[model samples]
Target: TTLLRQIAGFDFPDSGRITIGGESVERVPVEKRRIGMVFQNYALFPNMSVADNVAFGLSVRGEAKAVIATEVQRALDLVQLGKLGGRRPHQLSGGQRQRVALARAIVTKPRVLLLDEPLGALDKALRVDMQIELKRIQREIGITTIFVTHDQEEALTMSDRIGILRDGRLVQEGPPEEIYNRPKSEFAATFLGDANIFRGDSTGDGIRLADGTAIAAGVGAKLAAGAKASCAVRPERIRIARDAGTPDGNANMLKGQVSKRIFAGSNSTYFVERAGQTLKVIVQNTGMERLAEGQDVVLRWSPESTVLIAAN
Candidate 1:
């Protein structure tokens, strides 16, 4: 929120430059900066109609009435709320109200759009639907958007490039796939998604588990020999079976007992105990037999699925 505020000119930075469209806006006022922002709370005027709310920006700037009417309808249509222009904020559904907030933000055709957890107030289904809608509208308008959210799934779903920040510093920035699959640090690995982290001494190629098992990690293995390192394996990449089947030369294997099981609609999660560490494994339910709690199982995954990271 502080960072967004700085860019919006609501707050000034202690030291540094804020550039929008390759131009510095250090001395620019909020309205003149040509930035549009939508808050988590929607921040709509309670007594105004939807069209009035959408036209507020252009109206404040003294735009001609005819121009404001045309732009307001266009913005409302862009958000699929064209028919609800006469309704007040209180008369609309949560999703409709959100659309009103978005329409209002984009009505003035700002150069940059800043969304601070705009969908945080919606229900899960509505939020998911809005994620797709938001992406569609963004691509159609081709506006540079900066979205801030603590929900990991939301970040992954709506981003083209993701920047993971910790304590006001950027920990990592890359395409979503790269950040999720090839994290550079333990914080980045665990923050973006669920990861089964193995901590041990590095062997240049991979890390040796505490139980003397060699786990191979071909990606991001930059640590020197005998140094403290860790490898992260996403739960979905692991395959769990009751049989200690033939070991493949290219795969890492572990023997453990299922300590717990959770049944989600489309998948199942198994907590396996091995070497004093509980590893999480997610398996999709594809008509396959399910493993029971307390059952001995063998876990296998490809070396390519493992991500090597420096221990914090």
Candidate 2:
């Protein structure tokens, strides 16, 4: 929120510059920054009709009545709320009201759109629908959008490029695929998604766990021997099996006993205890027999699924 506020001119930066469209706007006032912001709360007028709420920005700017009407309809249609212009905030659902807020923001054709947790108020199902709808509208208009979301799934679903901030500093920035598959740090790996982290000493090719289990890194991992390092493997990448016999091929393997099992609708999560550490593994419910708790199991996965990270 602080970053969005700074861009919207609600707060000034302590140092450095804020540029938009190849121009500096450090001293620009809020209203003159050509920014459209939608807060977590819709902030619509209770007594006004949808059209009037969307027209408020243009109306305040003394835009002509004809121009306001045209722009308001255009914005409403863009948000898929064209037919609800006569409705009041009280008559609309949470999603509809959010669309009204978006229409209001875009009617003025601002250079940048700032969304501060716009979907925070919606329920799970509605939030998913709005995620798709929001992406569609963004692509249709082709406006530069700065979206602020704490939900990792929302970030992965909506972002073309992601900037991860940690401790008031930018830690990593990249496409979603790169950040997820090749996290530069342990924090980034576990933050964006679930990771089974194994802390150990680097062996030039991989890291040797405290139990003396050698985990080979991915194809391009490069680390000096005898350095503090860690390897991260996502839960879904590890496969669980009942057979104790070693499998063929150059796959990493571990022997553990299932400590706990959770059955979600589409998948099952297993907690396996090995060498005083609990490793999580997720297996899709593919009609195969589920592994029971307290059963000895073999965890197998390709070395390519492992990501090596240097300890901070």
Candidate 3:
């Protein structure tokens, strides 16, 4: 919140600079920043009606009553709450309250919109629904939005580009797919999703895990032989079978015994133990028979699917 408050002008930056819309906003007041912020808690006034809440920003600026009414109704309609204008925060559902908060932020037509875990308060189902709804509203308004969330899936699903922050510093920034598939570091690879890491010496061709298993990886530059390096593979990219059975020549292969299996509704995750390491593989549930725990399995994946990085 402190970071966001600084950008919103509630607090001053101690160093560096703050700019918005091609102009420095370090000296701009909060009310003049034209930055709309929706807090994690939705921060809707419980005593105010939905219409009043949506119109609050414009009203505070002394906008005419007719203009406030028009903008408030338009914002409410955009959030699909056109008929709930008279409802109070306490009387609305969690998703409805979220929409109300969003309406309030956007009703003033700010140049930039900041959302702090906007859907964090909703239940799983409602949160998913709001993700879609929020994206829809954002597109309709075409406003530049900065969304902050600890939920990896939400960031992936709702962002055009993502910046991963670690210890107040940006570790990586790129399109979601690029960041997920070609993470520059172990923290980025594992933090964004599930990654099975192979850590050992780089063999100039690929990575040789601690067990002496050399896994081929397609890397931009070959690492010097005997250099400490690591490679990561996403769980879903690996294919598991009873045997190698003439796997692709360019693919890396490993044999292991299934140590455990997690049965999610849409998918199944298997933890395979091979040479003192556990490799994770996720497969979609096609209503087919799945390998049981303790079953021997062969894992194969193309070299291109593996990401190589320094062992740091």
Candidate 4:
């Protein structure tokens, strides 16, 4: 929020430059920068009708009443809230209020839109609905947008690009899939999603697990032998079987006992313990024979499933 505030000119950065639409905006006032912001709380004025709220930006700019009406209606329609314009914020549902706030921000056609956890306050079902709605509106308008949220799934679902910030520095930035699949550091790997970390010394082909098991490195892994390294694999990439044929030598395989199994409707997560290390595997719920606790199983995954990251 503070970063957005600085870019919106509500607060000035101590150093560094802010540019929008090819113009420097460090010294520009908040209202002059043409950057729209939607607060997490929706921040709609309770006293104003949705139409009036949407028109506030253009009205403050001295747009004619006729023009304001047309633009406000267009903005409301863009957000699919056109019919609710006459309703006050208090009368609208959470999702409706969020849309009104978004409409208010974008009615002026700002160069950029900043959404600060715009769906954070909504119920889970409504949050999912608004995520789709927000993405659709963004695409339709073709406006440059920056969304800030701590919801990993939401970030993965809604973004064309992603930037992960930590300790006040940008630790990683890339398309969601790229960052999620090939994170550069341990922090990036675990923060973006769940990762099973295997820390060991690099062995050119891959890292030799602490148990002295040689697992093949995933594609695109870059590390020199003898250096400390870590490999990450998502639980879903691992396959577990109770009596599958022995895997080829090229495959990374381990024999373990099912220590636990968690059922989650669409899938089941199994915790397999082998050589004192616990490995996680996720399998779709296909109504097949499910592994029970204490059952012996083999976990197998291809080299492509592992992601190498900096140990530090």
**Ordered list by TM-score, greatest first:** 1, 2, 4, 3
Candidate number with greatest TM-score: 1
Estimated TM-score for each candidate: 0.98, 0.97, 0.96, 0.96
Residue-wise C-alpha lDDT for candidate 2, range 1-312, written one tens digit per residue: 998999999999999899999889978998888899899999999999999999999999999999999999999999999998999999999999999999898888899999999999999999999999999998998889989898999999999988899987888899998888888899899999899999899998779988898998884347899999999999999989997465566788999999999999999999999998999999999996888899999998888999888887
lDDT of 1 by residue, 1-312 (tens): 889999989999989999998999977999999999999999999999999999999999999999999999999999999998999999999999888999998888899999999999999999999999999999999889999999999999999999999999999999999999999998998899999999999988899988789989979859899999999999999999998688688999999999999999899999999988999999999997888889999999998999888878
lDDT of 1 at 6: 93
Prediction 4 global C-alpha lDDT:
0.88
Error of 2 at 102 (Å): 0.8
Error of 3 at 279 (Å): 1.3
Clash list (residue pairs), candidate 2: none
> What lDDT score goes with residue 278 in model 2?
97
- C-alpha lDDT (0 to 100) for residue 155 of candidate 2: 94
Candidate order (lDDT): 1, 2, 3, 4
User: What are the per-residue Cα lDDT tens digits for candidate 3 across 84-125?
Assistant: 999889999989988999999999889989998888888999
The parts of candidate 3 lying over 4 Å away from their true place are 219-222
Using TM-score as the yardstick, the better of models 1 and 4 is: 1
Error of 4 at 170 (Å): 1.0
Consecutive 10-residue window with the lowest summed lDDT within model 4: 243-252
How well is each residue in 1-312 modelled by candidate 4, as lDDT tens digits?
A: 789889888889999999886788899888888889999998888899999999999989999999999999999999998898899999999899999999999999999999999999999999999999999999999999999999999999999999999988999999999999888888888899887778899887678877788878675468889789888888898878886676477778878999999999999989888887788888899976888899998878888888776568
